[model samples]
Target: MPRFAANLSMLYPQHDFLDRFAAAAADGFEAVEYLFPYDYSTQELRARLSDNGLVQALFNAPPGDWAAGERGIASLPGREAEFRDGIHQALEYAAVLGNDRIHVMAGLLPDEALRGKHQAVYQENLAFAAAEAAKAGITVLIEPINTRDMPGFFLNRQDQAHAIREAVGASNLKVQFDFYHCQIVEGDVSTTLRRDFANVGHIQIASVPERHEPNLGELNYANLFNLIDSLGYSGWVGCEYRPKGDTHEGLAWLRQWKAQQA
Candidate 1:
């Protein structure tokens, strides 16, 4: 069965970031992932994970100047040095956190005219990051964020992500298959999973349109989970969603799923 990892960034917002580790454990999550871990010291983060008996499953590399609207620097030409530096920083944390994958965000593209140029830059940067991460036994991930959620995002389709991974030509370069975004971008989630399972290194989920709990979505997660298990996708499925109500209260679906699995 696919193991579930609470997305601490979205799921445990009621508590402070550090305290959310315990909250996730209390909620019966065996693993957790967040957007970034730069805010806390590696020792502190590691200690929290160890204490909570949770594994750090995934996280993103620094998206430059997030508040200023720089989602990522990897595909931005002339920001090569900054992107490389971000990779080094991410690896430093991964070493201590013991996580194996890092999602390299592709920032928004203001000019569609520069698509080819930006794509080349993205591929090159991914290759470089993959080389560095491979040294630390880490995999570099690229995700296809839906345009509706993130208009003009650089990477926005599964085929695009797969092509980039091929162009990068690195064993460690993989796709972070997010069901929420995939459903928004392309309708057939199950087929896509089977078709690209080889390229997929990790998976994430949230309901379509509202981005809530999996059970509340139009997509049948229970069946999808069965498909995932049958397909032998032995990777973490990140619960990356906004709670429709109280976080714990919104987990009735999870409780039921766990009961079924048990």
Candidate 2:
């Protein structure tokens, strides 16, 4: 069965940061994920999760500093120090949470001036991160966020993520493919996912155009989910979307879909 994990950060923006996890559990999500978990202490996060029997699915490592327009510069020329530090923080958090998948923000790959050097740095960093993550029995995920949705973000293609995985050559590194961004940057969701499913460790969804809950936009999410099920993908399908209304209202679509599936 394709189990759904709610991205608590997106689903319950109105709630306090720590409370979002419990809210998702109450909303019937067996697993919960988010963009950043750095604000809360690891002990507090784990306690909140245990109290609700919630599984921690996926989350990104720190992105240097979001305030300075620095998303992630893992492949940058002079930011390797900052990138490594961010990765350490993520490893600490993931280890404490008992979660295995840590989404690595690829940041913007350097421009053509030193593109070759940038690629080299990315591969080297991946090798080190993969080994460290493997030691913790954690899988590191490299996601390709759409540049249009998030300008200056590097690693914007599924193929790019695949290349990074190959370079790392580790069993613990995989792609965190997002449907909403992919649909905006590239259509044919089914074919794209099917072609790169082997590299994919996590999946996410949202309606196109508005980036809201599924079933209200261009992507035929039910069919997409069905395709994922049919393909025997046994991974978390994250509800990573901006709710058109409150979190509860957005959840009706998911609940109704579950009843139909039942």
Q: What clash pairs does model 1 have? A: none
Measured with C-alpha atoms, the lDDT of residue 61 in candidate 2 is 79
On the 0 to 100 scale, the lDDT of residue 50 in model 1 is 100
Weakest 10 consecutive residues of candidate 2 by summed lDDT: 106-115
After best superposition, candidate 2 residue 9: deviation in angstroms? Answer: 1.8
Q: Distance (Å) between predicted and true CA of 231, model 1?
A: 0.9
User: Where does candidate 1 stray beyond 4 Å?
Assistant: none
What CA RMSD would candidate 1 show?
Answer: 0.8
Stretches of candidate 2 exceeding 4 Å from the true structure: none
How many collisions between residues are there in candidate 1? 0
State the lDDT of candidate 1 residue by residue for 172-221, as single tens digits: 99998899999999989999989999989999999988999999869999
For each of the candidates, the C-alpha root-mean-square deviation to the true structure, in angstroms, is 0.8, 1.4
Q: What do the candidate models score in CA lDDT, each in turn?
A: 0.92, 0.84
Report the number of the highest-TM-score candidate: 1
